[model samples]
Target: MTPLTGGVASDIASLKVGDARYCVKFALPKLKVAADWRAPRHRNAAEYAWLEVAARVVPESAVRLYGRSDSAHGFVMEFVTGAETYLWKTALLEGQPAKGEARAVGDMVGRIHAASAKPNFDRSFFWNRDDFRALRIEPYLSFTAEQHRHLAPQLHDLADMLYDSTQVLVHGDVSPKNILIRHGRPIILDAECATMGDASFDPSFCLNHLILKAVHLPAQRTALYDEVAQFWRAYAPHVSWEDASDLEARICRLLPALMLARVDGKSPVEYLGTPRREQVRKLALPLIGNPPATLSDFVQTLTSRLKELDAWQR
Candidate 1:
């Protein structure tokens, strides 16, 4: 096996699984998209499920999972070689409008989420909360004593309100990196966090990454916001401003918590790890008090406020 790429969570390798060698992505337990906050997915099972669903719904994008044999902690997947979807999306974020690809990704995710349940694919594998730990509480609950003062009271109230507010089958970690834009379209990877319920979770996960990426490159914050809106527009066109208003409101409140949890929790991104981690927690701490009114309001306010934050940082 040849080393392709490596990170804190998972390491990508290329190996032969018979005559055709597929890309083997050995994912660590921490990177497996945990059950409680992130919700976990058995990679082998996810690969099999998505493969079956993709065969019917969005056939072009799904990969075939040979099987999984657990090693010390992490497991791997066999896949065909492809260009980096993260690089492709980053190019788009840099102004290359892969509009057709974006729409295709939207259509794919929508179809998969909306796909009819088939016999081979059991939705229960993903939806069950065996290790269901609220990831939202991580940043707040695990805060250092100094950080605790700034967060404790606010987190308490937020947790109280959000404890049982809503839950759903979420692709808890969808981002540019998890996607593969082969040529002009996106094929999704890593299905461990697919859960059932609030549709908001998946889209919110996508949106948060765009915002987080924008934070580092301050000048392109607005562009990132546009990209986020475009993706969301693709995912949920059926729900208009009136229909999805409540979901959006809830999503906005949940997002800061999500972002904070992501950074301060276990799999924090080293790129924005330490400093912005604290910044995100502090930023999200406020939403525990006043959530937005609708998705449109949430997206509008969320993106707009994020721009202001970038401007302030500059």
Candidate 2:
């Protein structure tokens, strides 16, 4: 068995049984981070349930589940290799921001949300908001709020709003690191934070990664921006459960707070240097206080700030 990296809340490994290879995952009670972060191991079961629902909704975009072991707090699933698929995060960091793959991801997420939002859809097995708060809300928003005292009220409000709102099932961690691309299709992984919560969190979490990548790789800013646009375009049409404008407004408010969370929260993105970290703070602070009314306005403001920073450096 070979251990997999890039995840914090679980122990993931590639395993082989006879001629067939599979990926096995075990949830950790204590997250592997610099902070004293811990959560319940039952989230492993929640993740498995999420995969089952996602596969039912979008078969092509979910990893094929093999079996799960509740006693061991682990599950087994399909093991895709680099020969068959590439990690989207690797490709984006290497300057290959494939807009097609981004759109595919957006479409898959939208379908899942739309399908699950139906009144008859069963969600009893996914009432795992405590796990969500332990993994996402507390660490990302609340922890960051603790550090940034001035933004405490706004950040806490965002956290409460996210925790209280329940529209559909959310694939909590939608960043590029959790996505694998094969033939322009995106297979999403890591649904430990999956719960019936604010739908905006998924899209906002994704777009935040693209914005962060643009910060880390300034040369690829335009390409990443286009990729973000494509992703939003593909997702916006699926906002049938609520007003698209209202959802976008929530996303705009949450996105910048999420931006700050990545920089100041428990699990900071490892690639950003100190200067770039400050850059994120400068860009996110004002937006959190007074977010744009629309996503386009937010992107335009972000683009202008990046350009201004470039000129200042020169």
TM-score of every prediction relative to native: 0.72, 0.98
lDDT score at residue 285, model 1, on the 0-100 scale: 58
Residue-level lDDT of model 2, residues 131-222, one tens digit each, is: 88999999999999999999999999999988887799998999999999876688888999989999999999999999999999989988
Q: Show where candidate 2 strays beyond 4 Å.
A: 82-84, 97-99
Query: Best TM-score goes to which candidate?
Result: 2
lDDT tens readout by residue for model 1, 1-314: 77776333456677775687776655455544333333233443543454555656666665665556554323445564555444444564465644555456656665665553224444665543332233323433344212446655655544455433324334544666677676656767755434443555566666677666666555666676666667656766644323455656656766665566556555555467565665665566565456665445555765676656656767
Candidate 1 Cα outliers beyond 4 Å, as residue runs: 7-11, 17-19, 26-44, 68-78, 82-102, 116-121, 132-169, 238-243, 273-282, 299-314
Cα misplacement distance, residue 312 of candidate 1 (Å): 4.9
In model 1, what is the error at residue 187, expressed in angstroms? 1.2
Error of 2 at 261 (Å): 0.4
